[model samples]
Target: MQLTIERIYTKTVDHDGYRILVDRHWPRGISKVNAALDDWAKAIAPTTELRQWFNHIKDRFPEFQTRYLQELEQNPETPAFVTEVAKQLQTTNVILLYGAKDQEHNQAVVLLQYLQRQPAIQALLRKE
Candidate 1:
């Protein structure tokens, strides 16, 4: 259950476990083959409308986080993704990969925080 967030473009891809892309859209200029990804959980990403509104504006990050969490709460795919990640954690580390340039303000960061706070996810991590 060692979860970490990483930029998709980073040179380090040596991690020996799940490397899931959590972005709604594929990163520009990166090919599927080059991504070295195990999964692309786009359903957990921010909606197109929300992404457009936030536009990575640093000033809007706080509000964006709140809004995104609300979206996640209602998103049916979130639970399934969390279950899947928890199951995977039984055996290996999990990387929630993202394409955002803002390391601290991306959806992956928020999603990671949300997941870490969940009791189910916490139990799984504790087992590891």
Candidate 2:
């Protein structure tokens, strides 16, 4: 299933079946009620070390992906969880909400890329 990015401040979509947050740290100003997220996949977010290392640096993307993938591979639950989230997208659009100011380079983007690469995930997304 395709993963779309959305800002936390934006209105929640009625068709958005499952709104999943892919950020490690919660947004500074938003409250839980305002988030409107169905699932907070914090477990899949990058480790503190990786988060600190990347820090949204554009040139460090190659290094970031390498380290992020390492984290994903080690976390057995992440792949399955992401695959399931992809499946959920089939029935309803999954809004991958994130709080990062730099939209281009963020954990959500990396997480979205990994989810889209799954064969089963693509199939599920295609049906929708």
Candidate 3:
């Protein structure tokens, strides 16, 4: 699947295939209409408890990534969500949008990596 991650604040464009806000909460200052989102995969995001514990601290990112991955593995919706994203990528680019200012240290980054590591997704990528 062709997947990418970007800040939700970035300007929308025609080429942002299936824009999905991967955040658990709506970003501040962005209107729903302006988001131009095809989906808001809140169920797949980190749990509120986990989010509060990490608090976006840079030093906590590694631990956060591990914890988030565990969360994803345990989350009942993740498999279905991943399948849906893969299906969408067959025809369009799937952008995983997030609100975090630190691009390298957000949940979206971890999620993207997790998606890429999946054998099914990797096979899909090889086909394209």
Candidate 4:
């Protein structure tokens, strides 16, 4: 099992799968109708405070990771939210779509790691 975040212009592979949008705000230029997204899982995205803090200074990635993890920890809804995505990943390739210019440091990267670490994701990987 694998998860990837791609820009709106990235080519879509021919596969049975789901593409989940991981951004809280609509991406600056992409229109909703043109996105062809399967679901918008905003719960996995960072809170507004976290986003603002990260965007405030690009030099604080490590700190952002810690704070984001903490924020996610207090959120009881994460497991179900992630599990919902995992269940879909099992049956199809999962693509996480994000709009951040700095794709490397955005919430999508954190979420990709978090989702991969899930026990369900581990089990699925072991089977492959």
Positional deviation of 69 in candidate 1, in angstroms?
0.4
Q: Which is better, 3 or 4, measured by lDDT?
A: 3
lDDT of 3 by residue, 11-90 (tens): 75434589889999999999988888999999999999999999999999999999999999999999998898888888
Q: Give per-candidate clash totals.
A: 0, 0, 0, 0
User: Model 1 over residues 38-81: C-alpha lDDT tens digits?
Assistant: 99999899999999999999999999999999999999998899
C-alpha root-mean-square deviation, each candidate: 1.1, 2.1, 1.3, 2.0
Candidate with better TM-score, 1 vs 2: 1
lDDT of 2 by residue, 1-128 (tens): 34577767666543346888888789888898778778888888899999998988889988998899889989977867867686687677777888888777887777778877878777776775
Candidate 3 residue pairs in backbone clash: none
Query: Which pairs of residues collide in candidate 2?
Result: none
State model 2's lDDT: 0.79
| TM-score of every prediction relative to native | 0.94, 0.87, 0.94, 0.87
Total backbone collisions, model 1: 0
Model 3 / residue 79 / CA error / Å: 0.5
Model 3: C-alpha RMSD to truth?
1.3
Evaluate residue 116 in candidate 4 and report its C-alpha lDDT on the 0 to 100 scale: 78
Best first by TM-score, ranked: 1, 3, 4, 2
TM-score of candidate 2 on Cα atoms, chains taken together: 0.87
